[model samples]
Target: MTDKAGIHPKYFEYCYVAFVAFLLLSNIAATKLIEVPTPWTNLVFDGGAILFPLTYILGDVLTEVYGLARARKTIITGFALSILASLTFWLVQLAPPAADWHNQEAFEAVLGFVPRIVAASLGGFVVGQLLNSVVLARMKQRWGEKNMWTRLIGSTLVGEGADSLVFCTIAYYGIITGGTFLNYLIVGWAYKVAVEVVLLPLTYAVIGAIKRAEPAYSPQAWAQREAVRAAR
Candidate 1:
C-alpha cells in the first residue's frame, strides 16, 4: 500500500521488521558482557555489539533502495519500540513475583534497562543511524552506482564512530575510565566496522535483490531523483 506515484516496494516490510527485531534483540544482548583473553588485553564488549552492526547494514539497505526519508522513519520506529519494550520490562520488574516463579532476579538481570543504559541505547541509535542514512544517501546521489563500496564503508565509519562514542560515554564513562575506557571505545568501533566490511558481499546481494524487486527502482529513476534534489 502506497500513495506515491512511482514507488511501491515489495520487500521493504521484511527489511523494516528485521531491522526492528535486531534492534530489540541487540539491546537485550547488550546486558551481557563478552570478554576474551589475549596477551595484550582482553577483548571486552557488551554482547549486543556482536549483533548491533546488522541494524546499520539494514539502515544502509533501506537508504540505498528506499531513500533516506524511509530509513529515518524506520530508525524512529525502532527507537519507539525499544522504549516500549524497556517500559514493559520496568513494569514487569515492579510486579511481585509468584512463589513458584524463581527467576525474577534472573529476568531483571538480563532484561533490565537502567536509566543510563536506556539513555545510551536510544540516544546512540538515533544519532548514529540518522547519520548513517544521511551520509549514505548523499553519497549515492553523487556517485550513483559507481562508488557503492565507498559509500557503504564511508557511512559506516562516520556512523559507527558516533555510536561508539555516544553509547560508551553515556553508559560507562564514569564507571570505566582511563586506558580501559579507550580500549572499549576503540575496540567497539573497530569491531563493528570490521564486521560490516566482512559482510560486504552479503550486503551487496541484498541491495541488488531489493533494487531489482522494487517495481519503481531503476538507475534512471534514481538519477531523476538526484536531479530533483539538486534543483531544490
Candidate 2:
C-alpha cells in the first residue's frame, strides 16, 4: 500500500449513506423482539439482530476501501445521526397530541425508546464500530491486504462481541434473567458473525467492485496512478 499522503479525500458517498441507513434502521427495528422456533428450542432475538450485522459489513468495506480516517468519520456520522433520531423521537413523543389523535399510545409504543435503551444503542454502536474499523485497519497494515476473509471474520468477532454484550446488558438488564441475557449475547454475536460469513462471497464482490469503481483514496491505487503520472 502507498502512503496516506498520496491518497485523496474523495469519499464514496453511497457507502456512507448505506452505513447510516443500516444503523438507523437497525435501531428502529430493535424496539421489538421476535422468536425463531427451531427443532430443539426457540431462538429469541431483538428484531434489530436481523439487520444490525450489516452495519459491520459496511464498516469493513468503508475501512478496507477508504482507509481508517474516512471510516472513522463515517462511523461518527452514523453515531451522531442515531442520537439525533433518538432525540427527535423522544421530543415527538413528549409533544402534545391533537384532539383526534387516539393513536399516540400506539405511536409511542412503536417509536418511544427508553433513555437506557437509547444510551445502550448509541454506546454499543460507537464502541463496536470504532473497534471494528481499528482492528481491520491494523490487520490490513499487518497482512498487506491479503486474507480479507480472516480479517473480516476476526474483526467481526471482536466488534460484534462487544456490541452484543453491551447492548444486551444495558437494554435488558432487569427485563430478562441473567441466563437469558447471556444467551442473548451469545446468540446475537454468533448470528452476526454467521451473517458475515454466509455473505462473504457477496461482500467480496461488492468490495472488489467498489474498489474498482472508486479507487481514489486507496493507497496502493493512488501510488499506481502517481507512478503513471510520473512516467507521463
Candidate 3:
C-alpha cells in the first residue's frame, strides 16, 4: 500500500526522542527558581524557563514538518513520559535511604514532586501543546504554506500565553503574591515567544531540510498530491 499522508517520516523517531528529552529535562529543571542578573534588573524565573522554550520550538518543527497527527502523538507521548518521570521521582522520594546516605534531604529537595506543581506542569503542558499544534495546523490550512512566521508567532503567542498563565497561577498562587505570579506569567510567556522568534532562521532551515528529506505529511501538501494523482 502506498504511504498516504507521509505519516512515517525517516527521521520522526529522532524528533520524538529530542522532544521527550527536552520535556523531561525541563520538568526536572523547573523545580528551582533562578535569579539572573541583567543590566537593567535582576530577572527571577524558573530554571526550566531557560530550556523549556526549546520544547515549543521543537513542537513547531514537529507540526510544521510532520503534520498535526504526528505532532499530537509526540505531544501525548511527552505528556505521558513526563507523568511517569514525576511518579518515579515521587516514589524515589518515598523510598527509604541507606544509613550511610547523608544527602536524603538534598535529594528530596531537588527531586520531590509536589502534587500541586506536578498538576500545574501536566495541565499546562497538555493545554499549551495541544493548542500549539491545533493552532499551527489550522493556521496552515487557512494561510496555506506561504507565511511560516505568522503561524509560528501567532501560535506561540496563544500557546505560551496559556501555558504560562496556567502554570504560574497553579504553581505559585499561594507561594507568591498575585502580582509576582502575574509577572512570572508575563515574563515566561514573553521569553518563550522571544526564543522562537530569535530562532526563526534556524527553524526555517530545519523545516526546509526536513521537507526536502522526507515525504510530504502536511494535509495541504498531501491533498494537493492526491488531487494531481486523481487528475491523471
TM agreement with the true structure for every prediction: 0.90, 0.89, 0.89
TM-score of predicted structure 2: 0.89
**Predicted candidate 3 versus true structure: per-residue lDDT over 1-232, tens digit per residue:** 1235334577778888999998888887887876677797556678788788988988999898877988998988988887788788888888999999999899887787444566787889899988999999999999888899999999999899889888887877787776666667777888889999999999999888888877665567678678878978
Flag the better candidate by lDDT, 1 or 3: 1
What lDDT score belongs to each candidate, Candidate 1 first? 0.86, 0.83, 0.83
Q: Which stretches of candidate 3 lie over 4 Å from their true place?
A: 1-7, 39-41, 114-116, 217-232
- Per-residue lDDT of model 2, residues 1-232, tens digit only: 2333454434468888988998888888888877778897677689888778999999999899888988898988988888888888899999999998899989888888644566788888888888889999999999976999999989998899888888988887788876667777778889999999999898999888887776574577768777878887
Candidate 2 regions off by >4 Å?
Answer: 1-11, 217-221, 224-232
Off by over 4 Å in 1: 1-3, 218-232
Stretch of 10 with least lDDT, candidate 1: 1-10
- What lDDT, from 0 to 1, does candidate 1 have? 0.86
How far off is residue 93 in model 3, in Å?
A: 0.8
Q: What is the lDDT of residue 36 in candidate 3?
A: 71
